[model samples]
Target: MYYDGIGTEANEKKGFELMLKVAKSSSLGAIHLKHHAQFNIGRAYFEGYGVEQNNKEAERWWIQAADDGSPNASVLAQTMLGMLYSRPDFLNLKQAFFWHSEACGNGSLESQGILGVMYLQGDGIKQSEASAYECLKEAADRGNVYAQGRLVQLFYNKKLFTKASDLARRVVAYTDVEELARDTGCLAAYITKGIAYACFYLSRCLALGNGLRMDKEEAEKYFKRACELDPVVSHDFHLDVAYGIL
Candidate 1:
């Protein structure tokens, strides 16, 4: 409540202090909550909620929480570490890969989706289409939008326009495209970007009658939506279409 003012005035410093106290406490009363406290403290440091932003301190606290053996906190902390190491300022691909792999093994849907991308692009490891397919399929089956987008791209590359169109249709079926585009979290941004990719591909399918009937009006609408979601991506997709890259 103090942190975000759920029912009271926000007091980030007090929230951080309480979390730190819980993290430092070794009593049985605190054991069940300590890992979560540690994770929150790391988040506070990372986002400068109540303290100076310090990536090192964030990393340290997250590592402690990740190793604390609380399944939820451990997985969350590991996933956070992966995201942290992926930042341009941090830029530790190997570390990012390791932490994501760790989180994936712990059944983190986000990490599983990211691992698929890494395998597909060879970002921090050897590229393997087979591994990419496996990871993407697993995550997509479990409703990971990021993995679904990449899988749709894979299908498109393999000339499976029908499958791509089907999946892309599902991805963009939601009614909150504008809200998704405006979200600030990394995962939400990725989801919005993925939705844009899906829209671009779906528009192509409509225009070319590859997997659906040719509908110029619908195609234009979706193409415009792709641009609205992510203009940079839309521009790149437009160039690819121009160059017969699809």
Candidate 2:
């Protein structure tokens, strides 16, 4: 109640203290709740809620939680660890892949989507089109926007422009990207970035009439929208074009 003031005052210090107490307690009653407490403590350390921000400390608590927590908490911790390891400062592609794979096997939608990307990109693992297709197909069917967007790219690469355009259009139909991102409980940046990629693909389809009538003006509008969502989309698109991947 104190943490985010959900039902009371927002006292981060008290919240952190309480969480720490629960996490450290060895009582039988606290055992079940300890993992949850540990997860929150990890979040506190990662975000500096009450103590100074410390990625190392965050990693420690998260590892404990993932190893000994409830199924839900363990999956979340695994996903967080995957993201943390992917950070440039602590980049460990192998570890990132391992955690994501673990979380994916445990039914994390976010990890499932990311595994597809890793397979497609040969990131920390050998590229396997079949594996990528299976992961992306399953995740997209489960309403994962990231997987849908990547699938669009996969179709585009295979010259299945019609299918790619259709998928991209479906992705763009999601007007409330923020709400979707929040509801999915995945990293908002990843969700939004995927949407941005869909926008870029849709724009290219429109401009080139790849699977539909060519409309330069319509393409321009989508192009602008893609950039608005993520300015980096345009840069990435250009690179893809140079590499003939788009």
Candidate 3:
């Protein structure tokens, strides 16, 4: 009630003090409150809320929360730990990998996607396309759009055209035809590279009937959309269309 003046005058120090007290003395009977308080302690220190910004203290509290062993708090703590470890300022990919692996195993789709991409590039672990594919596939199957986008290229490079086409379709669906047709290049510039890449592959699949029925008209529409959204995408589509590859 003190933190944001909820039902009382705002007092960040009082709120933080109470949180610290609960975090330090809570017993097993208050396991849930204890871990959450620990996480809040980390956030308070990290954000300099009624306390000096201390990265070391913040990290220690987060680790303490993770060790407290609440499944929900553990997943969140692991994710935060992974993000901190992966920060450009720090660059501790090994520590990032460990926490991300734990979070992924705990069913964090975000961790699964990050770990999969890391594995694909050997960013702290040995490069393994197989591991990347498996990890991404799990997250993609759960409707993670980012994982689906990454999988489009991975499956395409591996000649898994069917899988690539499916993922490509999912990724390209982000581009609404009505919006593309109405928006100018300035708006198109906001489209992400991953979406454009997926559109290119999907356009080719539709044009060539790669494991699916041919739809030249739809393929042309996607090709045009892809080109309008990104000239980089146009380069490949133009060459393939000119050479009868489409």
Please tell me which predicted candidate would have the highest TM-score against the true structure: 2
Q: Per-residue alpha-carbon lDDT of model 3 for 1-246, expressed as tens digits? A: 665578999888998998898888857766678877887788788779878898789889989887733467757677677777887876899989988888787777667877888899998899998999898788767655556667886877677789889778777877453364244211223235456667777877787788567899988887777776678757966886699764
Model 2 lDDT per residue over 83-194, tens place: 8998998899888899889888888999999999989999878999999999999999888888998998899889899999999999988877678877776677777777
For candidate 1, write residues 1-246 as lDDT tens digits. 677777989999998998999999989999888888888999999999999999999999999988843456668788899888889988888888888898888778888988888899998889999999999999888877767877888888888999999999998885564464344223676777778878888898899998789998999999999899889989999999889887
Q: TM-score for all predictions? A: 0.87, 0.93, 0.63
Error of 2 at 63 (Å): 0.8
Better of 1 and 2 by TM-score: 2
Pairwise TM-score winner, candidates 2 and 3:
2
- Residue-pair clashes, model 1: 0
Global local distance difference test of model 2: 0.87
- Evaluation by lDDT, superior candidate among 2 and 3: 2
TM-score of 3: 0.63
- Clash number for each model: 0, 0, 0
Name the candidate that leads on lDDT.
2
**Superposed model 2: Cα runs more than 4 Å off:** 68-73, 242-245
Instruction: Estimate the TM-score for candidate 1.
Output: 0.87
Candidate 3, clashing residue pairs? none
